[model samples]
Target: MAIEVASLPLPASADPSKFVDFGKEVKGIDPGNLTDDQFKEIQELLYKHDALLFRDCSLSPEQQYALTKRFDPASENYGHGNNKTGSTVKSILHPDLKTIPRVPQVQLIGNGTVYNHEGLATANLKHPSHTTFHKTQVSQIDEDAGITRYYRWHIDAALYDLSPPKVTTLYGIHVPHGKRQTIRYDDGTGDELEVPLGTTAFVSGKTMFDLLSPELKSLAVRTKVKYAPHPYVWMAPARAMPTGLGIESEGRELPLEELPPWEESKLKVLPVLWKNPVTGNLHFQVHPCGVMELLVEPLPQGAKREGALYPDGAHLTDIKEVRELLYKMQRPAIAPSLVYPHDWKEKDLVLFHNRGVLHSVVGAFTKEQVRAFHQCNLAASDDPTGPTADDIKKYA
Candidate 1:
């Protein structure tokens, strides 16, 4: 199908400078105080820029959560840590367990053990609210030792099988070396991607969610509960077998035990295009972690006995091939015209569409540097067909 493109919605002013005072130094904006015109301008900028960055505004956690409410309700039930920050706010990027001896608050968002039962793998679709939040702190890893503990480029909270978040926000608290960076491949072109400070890119979750294809829509229909087994039991290494099932009989169940390891260890990355149900615009592509490939069945034709031929009927040719394809879809080379880069400053708030853009953290900083941010999601109503006026109202 020919991909449809929506004309970029530019704000009334040709230069973005005229819309809002970029030089003003305020910790954050009170969403309730925003005028309709200002809100419209902010919305248009979010759609056009994919990501926005504010500089030097100091905001308290409570203020950050209050600001998020302007866009979406507080997701009280989603995150894993203390709820003291309020239902809407969640922490991202904290000290490592080994490095920081006694601070439980230092849990890295993507690191530590994947606690399946601790609500890490549950889908938001099952909840009556249809909205969820995830709070993660970044852990330190010695990249020189080939121990990169950070998550590879993937979407936020893929476990939520419902449509991706309508909007996502990342606020930088304490950047290391006075700098933090996030690599964003808004356009597909792998070659000329933009790398900006973490604070510079603002994205709309709605735009991100809109980029998903119908195939993904079908997958999202399957709730988190169905996929719960894999997240809970499989991601981590298995415990040793009991004594009764000793060495002699181990071979009999080798395949069964091995299946979970393969299933859990393999990485899954989704395609970049999301078909917008409301505007029919093909928002920017999203690179989510799971939902990349469902079940890869063996080919009916079987492997070729001859040279260089792939096995017939294989859902995916091989893991290497899958990685290559994901790289092609993910890099910044895909869409050069739409990508934008920004610099980070303290107390800057960004709102973005989860479906439209691909975002990543710059690998330059160490874990102890302290990059603090709060995030929230503006969820569409349960209907997968499209967003309704009611859905818009929920965020409003």
Candidate 2:
């Protein structure tokens, strides 16, 4: 089965200078029943594209697990990201629903908390059009769901555990229709459009690295960014700008010292520029908000620097400087040309490089919507810590 995976359809009105369809080589992949050779081919395509979107592929949980295992033999088969029970990703609307899904690995996620008694998502309709819901109202909903308080931009691993996940597969179970919106502007003017719903925005670290000023790029490549292990209850940051109707988790890292000890981990310093083990491309691997400190120096002679293993540096970059540069570096990487949200379709399984791209959920499913996706993450196949520190020096 030659997989026919396609790059996301380019935006209709994209500027030519900005947008490049990187996934051009792939076609629509239909793995009626995956073979070992086909799985290998899929791996090849994924490394090449950095992202792949499979549509209407009604793959079951067992099949999904098998495909993920194929990608990385060591991938965790635990159910619902819980290591104890090892559950599956299921379409459950709410966490409170006592009905445990049949599959141990199948766990339910989405805005089940906002659904009606019949399990339909009509909370927004209860307030009439989205326009009536206003920012104050929506922000309150978002705040309740921990978007304003807990959700923030980060690599999933940096957000949760220490070791970063390699590959992530998100299977869209249900997608909501975008509500009509008329956004009033500061100029007393307004714009009309349907809000983008349940879409995930992505920023490529490699692209961000390339876009950096030569001096900054050199500094970034040479520097080692120390990221504190993120807290279990992550406080959210308000975005500088809007990405459609949803909020963007922007700004600096929250203090971890005050948080529980178990919630924190020893700070790890990774090379700012990481080279991909599979594709051999260099990535700007540092997280904008997760950075706690910066070692503005190269690795020691004959030192191990992969997976962010390095001794502390005396010369440190100001946390403020790092955060500002990170924000600046991130902007272009998320420019209209570079940024593409997953315009999900029912049963569309999207496989993306977790290390390579920064992503965010868009539209407005804070607590009361029903867009479900079965997601699985694989541990790194190659060097998870990333490129050698010498590589950073050589490039710098």
Candidate 3:
């Protein structure tokens, strides 16, 4: 039987027209064992919708890794490199991921102790909390009152030598139920969202690009972002904004001289917008926290220059200036109305286009609230494609 595809339930604030095809629930097929034809169909569905959900799936780590690798056949390493996070103890990511010894590409994550999970005899996992990384956080009294915040907004990538992953797979092996929580943006706009406990919140990069005014769109298509070398280590000493959108410019980041040994030639300079391979649509895909510079290209010849931002080519190196520019371009897309906070269930598997969306771990779990999950994403074998000359001419 062919897979059954249906739209996921959206919040009342969502624009039905824009979300008509954003995320889908796939039924009538087993994700662990897909036929060749089924795999092709799944691929088409993933690119078209960006996120696909499979409920009540009994997926093994090996199966999850195999499925994720299918999207990028040449990829072999974990998104951050095998056991790399463990060695980089100062990295902000060190506390969150535990590599599965058998399948190094799959990570065992979540909160509380898990016994005999895959190759692990006994694993103690800690849920990443914003209190540890943010400049400020909701107080204990407020948290007990069900107030929380998004931990971080990002794409899964090493953001160094490796290419960004094409997709990410997450399997909920043991899901715990609890009271719902409220996410307070705390950026002074008084934005708040009621989210399910431990929800994985998502915001579409396509929506991020589409919501921009024409001028901003032109600017986005003409820009590239440069990431700091060993970004996680570099940003470890820093703190994030209360909204969790990006880092605050407090001059607390590790100095370049203090960062782990890095090479100028190995720094990543990627386009601000990534072109979707199947749909040909451009996604605003920058990882806001890691970005340190912007390279804006001049407008194409014969294109209108009036009311254009940086019509002449320019390089932006001021950290505050760079972050403010990115925040201005990306913040609107995370409004409650545009966000998708998936309420997970045990035995559920979610596959998302890593290059097409920004996601965050939301809410918090008590020490006793145990949750177990397997996540897999591989560093892609190739770099993302940028806008073509024709695209530049049209947008400019």
lDDT to native, each model: 0.32, 0.50, 0.93
Give the better candidate number (1 or 2) by lDDT: 2
Residue by residue across 1-396, what tens digits does model 2's lDDT show?
Answer: 344554467654334444353443244455436667777887877766677777778876556656766666865633224432112112111221122143333333445443432233332221112222122333554423423211223464533344566666666667666542212221112321222455565667677777877556656655767665532222222232232222223432345554434433444566666666577777776555556566766545554544332233335556556565566655556554565545667887777777776675444443455555565654443435555656555544
- Local accuracy of candidate 1 as per-residue lDDT tens digits, 1-396: 221223222322123432231112222443334566665655555545444444555554444444444444543222223232222121121221111112222221211132232223421111100011111222333223222111233344333323345456555444434333323222223322234333232233333333334333222222111122222122222211111000111112222344333344333233233444434444334332222232332222332223312222124423234434434333322232323333554555555555555544333333344444445443332312332333322211
- CA shift of 41, model 2, Å: 1.0
Q: Which ten residues in a row have the lowest lDDT in candidate 3?
A: 12-21
Q: Candidate 2 — what's its lDDT?
A: 0.50
Angstrom error of the Cα, residue 220, model 2: value is 1.7
Q: Best TM-score goes to which candidate?
A: 3
Cα error of candidate 2 at position 256, Å: 4.0
Model 1 earns a TM-score of: 0.46
**Tens digit of per-residue lDDT, candidate 3, span 1-396:** 779999987866566777876999999999999988999999999998999999999998999999999999999999999999988998989999998999999999999999988989998999999999999999999999999999999999999999999999999999999998999999999999998899999889999999999999999999999999999999999999988899999999899998889999889999999999999889999999999999999998887889999999789999999999999999999998888989899999999999999999988899899999999999999989998888888887
Give RMSD (Å) of candidate 2 vs. truth: 7.9
